[model samples]
Target: MDKLRSLTLFLATCEEQSFAAAARVCNTDPSTISKAVSRLEAELGVTLFQRSTRQLKITAAGRHYAQTVRSSILALSSCEDELRQLNDAPRGRLRVNSAVCYGHLYLRPLLKAFCQRYPEITLELSLDDMHVDIIEQDIDVALRTGFVKDSRLVARCLSPMDFVVCASPDYLKQHDMPVSLDDFNGHSWIGFKIKETQQLQPIFLPDADGVYQLCELHRTHITDDGEAMAQLCADGFGFAQLPHFLAKAGLKSGALVSLYPAFRAPMPDSGVFAIYPKRAYLPARVRVFLDFLVTALEAQQETPTHTWAQHWPPHVQFD
Candidate 1:
């Protein structure tokens, strides 16, 4: 008698509480399920179930044993999946989820190149600023920042989400440019009301020495969207602490000016991470894309934009 097979049959019987039901679930005869459960009981030297013609009942020990058996079976299944994935090619639809600003600033630029490189893989990208359940939504990958508390997902750090306090050149010219930490208290701020929490997020800034100061910013204008807040700041609303990815283009274009660039420090729990659902067998397409992103992001950090064009495939073009 196969011990694993017998254990599986026993667990199925415990769940359904009927040999016939377990048989239907396992696609086997009722007698086979019954014999397997009986064999399992004999091997364990325990009567796992109290059986009768009318109904079957699980013992107290059986209930406790089922819990352990279920976990072991799941681990075995995951191992089997991993083994199968080892031989599988990287062709398939790779579903990705990301925030809007990150998608536009970071991911959107890379898609054409990624598609060209992996012609067999089809990319299905979904953008939403709000957090969605990755497993429930069937998203293969998610580009996200900040702390990840989900135990069911694997988060690989790509970059630090460096927060840059900046505003429009016109706004800074109208008001005093924040030269010191004490100067921020005198300034009005464009506040971001978080959609998830519905509260105005406190501004956290760091100085040259890497010490952080928290500010309960005086909100002159409020919006739930990060992009909207950035646009408002660029339109000369007030000072806003924006993520570097969102502010980089504006800074380069002279639409926004970085306030105290020398004072920038790493924000706590702030990271750009490629998050994916935890699985033993990560699809090859998803794995390669993640590797590509890590390499691309590293190059983007090290090389200047004009120089980055040289790294691209000759047939691919970027502006």
Candidate 2:
């Protein structure tokens, strides 16, 4: 008289409406099935079945109990299946998409280590500046910067997107360094044009009240590519506002010098995000890769040379 075995027999009896048929389903004799149900009824102090010579009728209470027990058993079975899937070695082709500069500068370097760690996962990475439909492309995951507007995707913020207004040392030598926002009027500016929209990307700067406001500057040079913009700025084109990922290398190498140290661009919907299609059960390969990427980025943040976001002046630090 195991409780679960009794419940299973009760459910089968309720479904079959006959002890003999239930016995057939349970691969036991009718008398054994009847005894199990009788034991369950005795324990619950409720007559589950209205047994007659010709008909075996289930009571309303028996019907309700059967429904509840069936649901519980199904849930338990689903949990067990999920656990088995998790325990299995993750193996699959993991298709990942990313923005061009981010893929090249940040993600490309980590692929070798990721491949070594998860040898079973076949990694397919595609880099594009324009956002692509992941579902249509069958992409498993995508690394994106700035806001994720699609309601169909789940976006996990990996890091904050910080922008630095900087110029190369050679450019700084030729042009007078601006001490204030007003002084920027006389300085040349390099701008990034959005390839998708064919419009110049707006530059936002924090005001005295720490409110971010869009600032319009005369563009001396413009490019659709972030890396190209960073390069132009580094080669003495002009001062440009560059994302931290694109500017980190130059800043560390002294090829670029940050301007307006106290000012920061706190733009809304600005962050580094790992995006994937919304799903009830995320594949193990995608899940492991996401976990690996997060850990790798955290380790990078701890090291001075490989930190994704730059540490500004102590007074201007923000979480």
Candidate 3:
């Protein structure tokens, strides 16, 4: 009789409390279960059960041994599961979540290529402007902008977020271009409202010393959506501070003009991140998706489509 097989049979007998019941559960004869338990008892130098014709009763020592063996079996099973996951091919449903604007501008374009590369992975993407609980939502991975403070998650910085103060060409033509921070006094402002907090996002302006300071500007137009806010600004509403990802197209197409490109907010939450729940073993699907996204983003940086850093002064360095 194999030792592991004997242990398994012994545990089954302990759980069932009857050789016949254990035999039925293990798909063997009652005699086999009895022999395995008897051998286990002899090896341990203790009588594990008080067997009578009517019922089988476990001793205190048997109960304690069962508890120990159960935990060891569970630990062994967990190790085997982790090893299997590590070696398994990437094939499963991968649930991904992303912020709305970033998903539209960046992630959406790369989906087809990712799917073509990993045909085995079924991709399910959810785009929301509001933050979500990845663990509760059963999300495998998430793309988020700004600083991630959740202790339960692991965040990798995909790119640095840059905000550009911009206005439509018509608006800049009508109003004096803000050459200095003092010139912002009478200018109309278009602000972005955070739907979650129901508060307007703060505007950070650089002082004469180039230090960013939060300033309150009267908002002439406000919207929770980044695209809508950019549209309102482009339609000659007011000066707005927009994320580079949102402002890039407008600036390139000559719809919007970058105002005070030298001054930028040193926001604490200033990076686009790839976020996921921390685990001992990462699934192959998730690992491949992250790798694909990183590679794609790196390729985009090599082209003019995502040249966000080019808008900044040459002296500034980003990681």
Candidate 4:
């Protein structure tokens, strides 16, 4: 007989006080229970029970053994329960990545609420603008702005990359705000340079025909950092077209002023997206985080329609 099975049968027989009764409880024959307990007593070199034809009574050794093994049995049952919970609930270390500005401005606040709701989930978040290989870096989810070209990954749109032209109050006070596209001709511009291509990031604006056009601005100051460009714009360095994530608060607090509220930029594919690797079964934690992020970002916007404008033409580009 197996040792664990023998121990269980022995304990049941001891507690029930009769082999026949223990067999009834265990759904086994009385002879099987009798043999298992006899084997257990032999292995332990202890007389566990004193049996007579009329009644069966447990020895002192049998009572002591039952008391000792009861705690171990309870602990084993508790471990099984924990394993079951691990399979059903979202409770584990979750790795996530996001761009610096968006992480700080939007994701940072949402994290507190998410943690509070799911206290069992441990989160590891990395905030940076540098491109990362999610598989290589072991990242479970990534919040990025712009095109997601990797076929190995699945992308979900979080918000539109609505470019808004803004300038510091000091700069606008010193120089007139550009009301038309032509007014940008001689103004000092703070621009963004592509890190990989080393070329000026294309500025998309509308033409006289209401169609979108791209103009590569000649910049007096350029950087590959989004936050730096926004800061320079706020510090009165020059005018910059910044994403709403970086420019919204400054515009509201009067540190920066928006130019041409009616004109919208053309960025069909340049939207904030959450990317994750293609997998047959995505973890429960990742799915919950992605859904929570979308809800949190929407709460900060004026309206869903305004946050994602639909007037831009489909895949329009300029050579």
The models' CA-based lDDT, in order, is 0.75, 0.78, 0.79, 0.75
Candidate with top lDDT is 3
Between candidates 1 and 2, the one scoring higher on TM-score is 2
Which residue pairs clash in candidate 2?
none
Q: State residue 32's C-alpha deviation in candidate 3, in Å.
A: 37
1-319: candidate 3 lDDT, tens digit per residue: 9988998888888768899999998999999998998898889999889989899999999988877786566456446547888467878789999999999988999999999999999999999978787764558899988645888689888877777777888887798666667667688899899887899989987677656689977887788999988899999999888887788788778788775553435667657888987766577888999999988888767221234545543221211
TM-scores across all candidates? 0.66, 0.68, 0.68, 0.65
Q: Name the runs in model 1 displaced over 4 angstroms.
A: 1-87, 178-182, 206-210, 262-268, 302-319
Better-scoring candidate (TM-score), 3 or 4? 3
**Candidate 3: where are CA atoms >4 Å away?**
1-81, 85-87, 262-264, 302-307, 310-319
Deviation from native of the Cα of residue 21 in model 2, angstroms: 55
Q: Judged by TM-score, which candidate is best? A: 3
Off by over 4 Å in 2: 1-84, 206-212, 262-266, 302-310, 313-319
Against the true structure, candidate 2 reaches a TM-score of 0.68
- lDDT per residue for candidate 1 within 31-115, as digits (tens), equals 9998998887887899889988798999988888887886576567557657778686677788899888889888999999999
**Compared with the true structure, what per-residue lDDT tens digits does model 2 show for residues 1-319?**
6788988888788777899998997999999999999998888899888988899998988878876886576556446546768476777688999999999999999999999988999989999878787754557799887655888678888877677877888887887766556667788889899888899988776566656679877887888999999999989988898988888788878788776442335567667888887665577888889898888888768231224445553112221
